[model samples]
Target: MTKEKESILDVKLFKRLFQYIKPYKGVFFGLLILVVLLAIFSSATPYITKYAIDESIETKISTDFLFYVVLMFVVLILQTVFQLLFIYYAAWLGQNLVMDVRVKLFNHLLRFKMKYYDNSSVGVLITRAVTDMERIADIFGQGLFMIVRDLLAMVVVFGVMIYINWRLSLIVFLMLPLLLYATRIFQKYMKRAFEEVRNEVSNLNSFVQERITGMKILQLFTRETIEYKKFKTINERHKKGWLKTVWYNSIFFPLADLVSSISIGLVAWYGGLNVVLDGAVSQGDLIAFIMFIPMLFRPLRQIADKFNTLQMGMVAANRVFKVIDTTSQIDDTGTYVAEGFKGDIKFDKVYFSYVDDEEVLKGISFEVNAGDTVAIVGATGAGKSTIINLLNRFYEIKDGVISVDGIDIKDVTLSSLRTQIAVVLQDVFLFADTILNNITLNHPEITEAQVQQAAKDIGIHDFIMSLPNGYHYNVKERGVMLSSGQRQLISFLRAYVTNPSILVLDEATSSVDSYSEQLIQNATDKITKGRTSIVIAHRLATIKKADKIIVMDSGDIVEQGTHEELLKKKDGYYKNLYEVQFLQEEVI
Candidate 1:
């Protein structure tokens, strides 16, 4: 069996947890009051029988006895009515409590930096926040009130037994030590098993998500047999975890039954012998004694199961709190945006790395004037993307200053800095929604006519209209409904709709066909007429028309000049890239 870790919470969790409930204190007080009332009513059931047997059965017919019987009936009816009402409100309050927590967790995750998402997985983050939060919520919903009910009932049940006959009560209570010992052992085992079960579930979810997304890849490589074999390994691990749980659970039930059986047998032997030999206990008291034994021990049995539930919930709570506990190291404190951007982009002696002791960008420096088309041409993994990412502030600079419009990008608010910049990345992502919605997300209030005009100028409107729903077509996940060239065209339109002052196009037209390229080139030429445009592409055909060409290698700028000026340096990186794609080297 798997070993259970220590409880998820310490003293600190209780203090932090209470703060979230401060606004709903009144509802909690009402719940506590109802729990007390329910417990009191349930605890009185044994008492009513004791009185009926001891007094009413002896006298046979007295006005006092009749009046007591009627009173008992009235109490039962009142208990049932109020108990139903208690359930309704308890459930309502529990739902609202979980709703509040879910909303807070989601909003908090959004506030964290992109780096947080980069380092975390989809399954782990989702399971912790959603499924784990629900487990913690069960404590307040069903478990809390049940604990109070059983506790109150135990005390009153014991009092009734002692009053009916103290000697018999003493005999039945003797098994308390053995019961507690057995429970502690079983609880330890079950908690560990459940934690393993949770881990296995997480693995299953992660594998399932990956398999679905990469179904095409598996088929492409003809690796279905290998994939199936790998999946079996995960499945076996999950089954082993479950078997440990099942085995422990199977042992506990029989052990609980043995304890309960012994308790009952001991009560019967003592109660029966006393009546026959010494007249110490009456027949009526014996019946009530026997019935109350199960009532007493049943709650204890449930406490064993409930405590298991409580601890399992706590394990989940730790995972949920771990997410809430994460605080982004990077935050934007500046609240103002530059009134008018001069498009003066400057990077001064920037040094950065994603991993320690291994630099990605090493002391890179460059500057671009307002309304200039700066094209960066370099080999793969030459840190071209790193420069674009730094400008977007997706990753923090270890040392150096990246300024926009003479203000440090770090000093400006993230929202404002990103708002002024527009990026058309090589990997074009589109939500499964209408074409119009995808283009206008950055400017949702943009007129439909404006959207069509933008698409028509980019030469994709006619192709889009050829589809059944035209602009209203569902894009499918990641725009799978459209071809690569078609998706690239729409991605360009999205950036155009934003109307940003600084536009970053990373391999923007690499996927588009030649026919669509001239059209997109015409539209892009019009949009970048007065805007600062930064283009990063290996294709010399695309960057040849740029006002300035920057050639990069090993995260450092090797050469910078006008296209004609760079071409004059015959052996330079730009000149080499031009020779590779020489067929389309002409800039229209």
Candidate 2:
């Protein structure tokens, strides 16, 4: 469960929440008016009944009794009309409020730095956006406003009972202290119970999302039984949390009903004696007190449950607002737009770390001149990818300046800087969409013909034509419908279509077969021509034609030269790497 502190009935949080309703104030006020009208009609019914009975008890044909019955019937019809309108408008307001919140949350997420995503769980975020937002909608639909209406009805009923007979009203009022005490205790514990339940729900969602996404790995390792046991453990916690709330409900509601029944019994016993012995209370007044007792206590009973609903909604809103208030985003304060960029990139004594004091790139400095292709060759975890990520400002550098064309890249707008660069990562991610949509990413400027031409230029047009619908063929979630090599080809086509000024291939061809590698190599040459390029590769043979080679090891550049220049050294890092990889390729 999350270790965050649970908040109860936070007034400031509610004050902040009401800001979302500002746009729909007219609908909100109209709903309140309906609640008041409904309460008046509903609370007036028993008094009308008392009037009809008391006036007609002495006469067989009293027109006053007949008139009161018709009046009560008309009141019911009006109450029903107001109730219908209240339900419809309340739901409308709730849906509109949630839609606004969901959009704002999504927009906030989009601006967040990649570091935020690195530390956050996908399932938790999804729960905040989808599940938690629904709870917030319940605040308007069935939570705070509904509680208001019920309490208003209770107040009116209590006032009418006092008007009918102050003596019987006192008996009913006496029952409140006991039920009120019970309700207070119930509300306190129920808030804690709801917090546990919501935490458990988030935990379950996280576990399920992770397991399903990695199901292939689990099955390959034959750990299904082990995973199943883990799942059962999490599910058990969720069940326990819910059962605690159920237990509280079972205890409190029955006690409330008992107290209500006791109030009616007391009223009957006392009022009947007065009617029979002293004539202090009439038969109509006694009957009206019975009706009023339930009306007064029912809302009291329901308010506890409804208040819990309000508390849960508040909890959900707190979690979502935390995300919206997050400051983990790249500062795109620069207004300089990189139009017709020459792509002269430089990293000058840069330092970076994903975690505090654990540097991944240490005082590394390099430059890529206009139209030059620079290849970075290193073993795994040698800070090759870190350099690419820094160049794109996916993360802020710890202690250095990175510049493009002699100006700090931080001074350039993120959109303009990124628009000129196209990257093909080793692990390509495609949406559950058609090939054409994935390639263009639904950009209005890039037409289908442009994508086809780019595919043809990259030597993968025929491969695409072989699919079911060519460019229109769906590549399920994360492009699972295609093989690794085929996905890489699609990624290449995506990059080619962008016409970026600088091209980056982060081990793009490493995951593919020899045939796909050859195809990607051809595509690489076509795109990198007359464009500054950075290629990180484990395969030394693939980058033989690079304008320059920077060999890195343990977060530092150990050597920098061309392939032939480095190979001439008898004891050089690149030479040793080339010899080992050459022999390994031959063995394979």
Candidate 3:
């Protein structure tokens, strides 16, 4: 009932689909040639049938009939050959077109920002990538070819009918409007039913993916029965939706058949009456008229079916275009970045909000001199992460200038600006790839020795060597094959390999065991030796060696000091955090 309708299937879909066939216009010309040949041969068939019925079988000694029969067979053979090639070319064009579309759509998806990924569902995205692409292929391979073949056949059938007997042809075509009205009615029902079917299928796919990914959580909570019920609900909905679609399609075919049968019956009865009562036409002419009746409506019927398929394909196009329609809010409009930035960062009265009314970062100002190590400490949701995110230009600032080396960040190309910075996030993400490859995600040309050196610096090289494949060892999705500490070690290596000018680590060791955390802290101290760094944590021990500690509360900086200076101030927030952390550890 609720539809997020826009022109997702606008001129763009047609333009893209057309561009795919631009190289194959020769194929289009060939298809047209085949259509015309098939039409001429199809029109000849009724005459061949009429001759057999009224002359050869009725007269019993016609030498010319044998020659006509042989000629008919030759036409039949030639048409079959051309039709086969027509189908082959159509299929080739369709397969390649869909493949191109999939490649383009996927690459476009990669260019989008984090906010785009955050708001979308994985199941819907996956469905667009695969199932919807298949639908467009169907349109090219079968739908377009079938409609063309049927239409040309209709044109030939009509010319023959009028030449044979216009009165009967006119009477037979009276039922055409009835057929159109019937399709309009059925299409309304089918579209809504099929839309529901697609949605249900998407739900089932998402349910399976989530259950597979979260099997551990489900088992931990002992919710196998509850999950089973949820799966059954989605599966049954999909089943019911499909059954409804089948029911509609099944009735649809029969309705067309009934209309066709009635029209054919009327033509037969009238043509027979003219012969019996008035004798106004020859036996051969009556036979030819009878043959033309089905030829006319069969194509018309096929045209309806292909139109139905077109509507279905358009529905899929609409879904795929939704992703294509989404604009990247964080747009890059500048030339390449300046070759060397001094890493002098400033947040000048910065403001940002995820939503219109709820400000995530209120008016705040800060400065970090080039090569300085600054530690940010705050309560949860104190906008510490927001400050680092803005500096990297990940989310565009709502107001004020965030500058790097005194140049507005918005003026630098996003890719160029990011190349000089490295971020070590609280949540470590590693691909299902070799350990060596994960470390050098961007700097792929780096040697194995370089990878090992970075890992050894982080105190993780020895552990990687302990694995069966050493540096070549494979990590599972999200590095699930490794322990929590191993994942953090790999993430740190990924950052270090970049040898970035600016380093920002956000709770980088939050989930690691104490032994690994200490190793990481020591490694980080070395990595940040000369680079401008913003280290966000409240662990107290991690920030003790920082050149300056920034204490923030509710989007405002409350204190700024060195570790010993902050500890000397008994009433400061930094001292309170340090006391709480030390006391908690002592209790443990």
Q: Provide the overall lDDT of each model, using Cα atoms, as 2-decimal numbers.
A: 0.77, 0.88, 0.78
The candidate scoring highest on lDDT is 2
Candidate 2's displacement at residue 535, Å, is: 0.6
The stretch of ten residues in a row with the least summed lDDT in candidate 2 is 1-10
Q: Which runs of model 1 end up more than 4 angstroms from their true locations?
A: 1-9, 62-73, 85-88, 442-466, 508-519, 582-588
lDDT of 1 by residue, 1-588 (tens): 222245433446546655667678888778777777876777566667667776777557564677667777887887897688667666666567767777878988877767788787777777877777777776566555566667777777778778778888888888867777877787777777778877887787778777878899999999899989988999999999989867876877677778778878888898889879997877677778778888888787877766666666666766677787888646777666755577999999999887788888889889989999898878777888888888988888999999987888888888888888988888889998888888887465798888888777656688779887988888988899887767777878888877688989876565668876666666667667788989886455557678888888877888999878877896987777776664355543
Which stretches of candidate 2 lie above 4 Å from their native place? 1-7, 586-588
lDDT of 3 by residue, 1-588 (tens): 433333222366566668777777888678778777878777887877677657676667687688778877987898789778878887777788788878878988887766677677677788889988888787777777778888888888888888877887887778878877876677677767767877887788777877888899999999999999988888999999989878877887788888878877887788888878986655766788767767877777777677567656667776777777778757788675766667798888888886677787777878889998899988888889888778777777789888888888888888888878889888788989988888887465888898888888767778789897998888978888988877877777888888788889886555678888776776777788888989996465667667888888877788888888988997888789877774475466
TM-score of model number 1 = 0.91
lDDT (C-alpha) at residue 550 in model 3:
87
Rank the models by lDDT, top first: 2, 3, 1
What digit string (tens of lDDT, one per residue) describes model 2 on residues 451-559?
Answer: 9998888789999999999999999999999988888888888888988988888766556788888887788778888999999865655568789999999899999
- lDDT of the structure predicted as candidate 2: 0.88
